[model samples]
Target: MKKIAFATCVHLGLSCIEEIYRIGGSLDLLITLKDEKAKDKSGRIYLDEIANEHDIPLLKIDNINDQEVLSSLKEYQIDWLFIIGWSQIAKKDVLEAPTLGCIGMHPTLLPIGRGRAAIPWAIIKGLKETGVTMFKLDEGVDTGDIIGQGVIKLDQNTTATELYKKVDDMHIALIAKYWHDIVSNNVILTKQSSADATEWPGRKPEDGEILSSMTMDETDKLVRAVTHPYPGAYYKEKERTIRIWSAKTDENDGEIKLSDGYLIPIDYEIEGNYGR
Candidate 1:
C-alpha cells in the first residue's frame, strides 16, 4: 500500500479516515486545523481520536500551504494525500510534495458547481440534483480530474443537515471503494470540462439573514439551506434576533409572516433560548 497522508478538519474528513482505517488501510499522517482556527467554521471537529487510535502522527496546522506543513509532508515521504472537509486550497509546493497528486472531495458534481459553500448554494439555486466528486487537486478551484462521483437527489424539503449527512456518507463510501485502486496506481482520472463549469461563491453568516420581502418558499429554502450545522437563517425582531433553525409552510398561523405567506417554525432560538 502507498503511504497516505490525510488532511481534514470536519466530520466528513473524520468519516473518510475512519472508513479507510476500518478497511485496514494504512495512514502515514493525519493533518487537521488548530483548535483556535476552527472557531467560526461550522462542522469542524477534532480528529484526535482517530489519530490516537491508529497511532498515526497527528499534526495540527493553521495553513495547509505553510512551509512547516510542506516540510512535514516531505519528511513523511507521502505517496498520496487526501484533503477533505478543509477550507484552504493547497499551493503548488504542498500539492507536489506527495508522490501522487493530491485529492479533494467536493459536495457537488464538478464542471457544474465547483466552489465554496456547495450545500447552501445547491438549495439556494433550487438545484434538484447534486452529487459528490472525488478529484485530483490542481491550481484552479475544484478543476481537477475526477476520480469518482455519486449522484444525490434533492427535494424541496431537503435541509442542509440532511444533505450534509448524505454527502458525508458518500465521502466515506468513495474512500472505502477507491483507496485500494488509488494506492495501487490503478485509478483513472477524467478531466473536468471547462465549458460546462460553474462556481459557487462562499457564503457568510449574514447571508442567512431573512428578509421580510422574501416569499414563503424563499424563506423556507433559506431556512433549510443554512440550518443546524451551518448558521441558522434569522430575522431581526426589534432588539432581538430570532434564528429559525427549521420551518414548514403548511401552517398559516405562525408568528413570522413572509411576503407570500407565513412559516410555522419547527425550531427556533431567540437570544440563545430555543423555542418551537
Candidate 2:
C-alpha cells in the first residue's frame, strides 16, 4: 500500500479528506494551518476532530515548506502528498520529497485558468463553464501535468456559494474515481498546453468594492462572484459602507439605480451590522 499525506485548512479540503476516508483510502498524516495563521482563510475549518476520529496524526504548521514539515514528510516516506485548499506554494525540496510526487487540486481547468481567485475569475469573466483539475505539482503555480479533470457548467445566476458546493462535490467525485488507479500507478498524465493558457491574478478584500460608475450588470456579476464563502461585494457611501450579499437585475424596482438598469439587493449588510 502506498503511504499518503493530506494537507488542507478549508472546507474544500475537509470535504476531500472525508471522501478519501469514506472510500476506504488511507493516509499516514494530515496537515493543516495553525489556528492563528488561518484567520484570514475563507471557509477555514479545523481538522482535529476528523483526524482524531480516524486516528490519523495531524500536523499543524505556519508554513508547509518549513524544515519541520520536510522532516516529517521524509520520516513517513510518503509516496504522494495531496495539497488541497492550501494557499502557500510548496518548494522544490518538499515537492521532490514524495516518491510519486506532490498533487494539487485546482478549481479551474488546467493551463486555461492557472492562478489565484479562480472561482471569482470564472464568474467575473462570464465564462459559461469552468472545471476542477487534479494535477501533479511542480515549481510553477498550477503549471503541472494533468492527472484528470471534471467540468462544471455555469450560468449568470451562479453565485459563489453555489459554485463552491459544485466544485467541492466535483473534487470528491474525481478523487474517488481515480483513487484505485492512483494506488495502482495506472493514472495517466497529460501536459498542459502553454498556448491555451491564461492566468488570473489574486484578489483582495478591497477588490470587492463596488464602484458607482459600474453598470447594473457589472454590479450584479461582481456581487454574485464574491458573495458567500468569499467576500461580500460592497458599496461605500459617505461615512459608511453597504455589503451586498446578493443582487439581481431582473427586478423592476431596486434600491440602487445604474445607467443600464437598477439592481435589487436580495441580501445586504449595513456598515456596522448586517441587514435582511
What's the lDDT of the predicted structure labeled candidate 1?
0.87
Model 1 residue 29 lDDT? 93
* Tens-digit lDDT string for candidate 1 (99-204): 8979998899988988789999899888999989999998888899999998999999899999988988888888988989998988899988899999889899
Per-candidate TM vs. native? 0.88, 0.90
Backbone collision tally, model 2: 0
Candidate 1: clashing pairs of residues: none
Q: Write the per-residue lDDT of candidate 2 for residues 52-73, one digit (tens) a residue.
A: 9999988999999998888898
Candidate 2 residue-wise lDDT at 171: 94
Off by over 4 Å in 2: 34-40, 250-253, 272-276
**C-alpha lDDT of residue 1 in model 1:** 70
Candidate 2: pairs in clash:
none
- The TM-score obtained by model 1 is 0.88
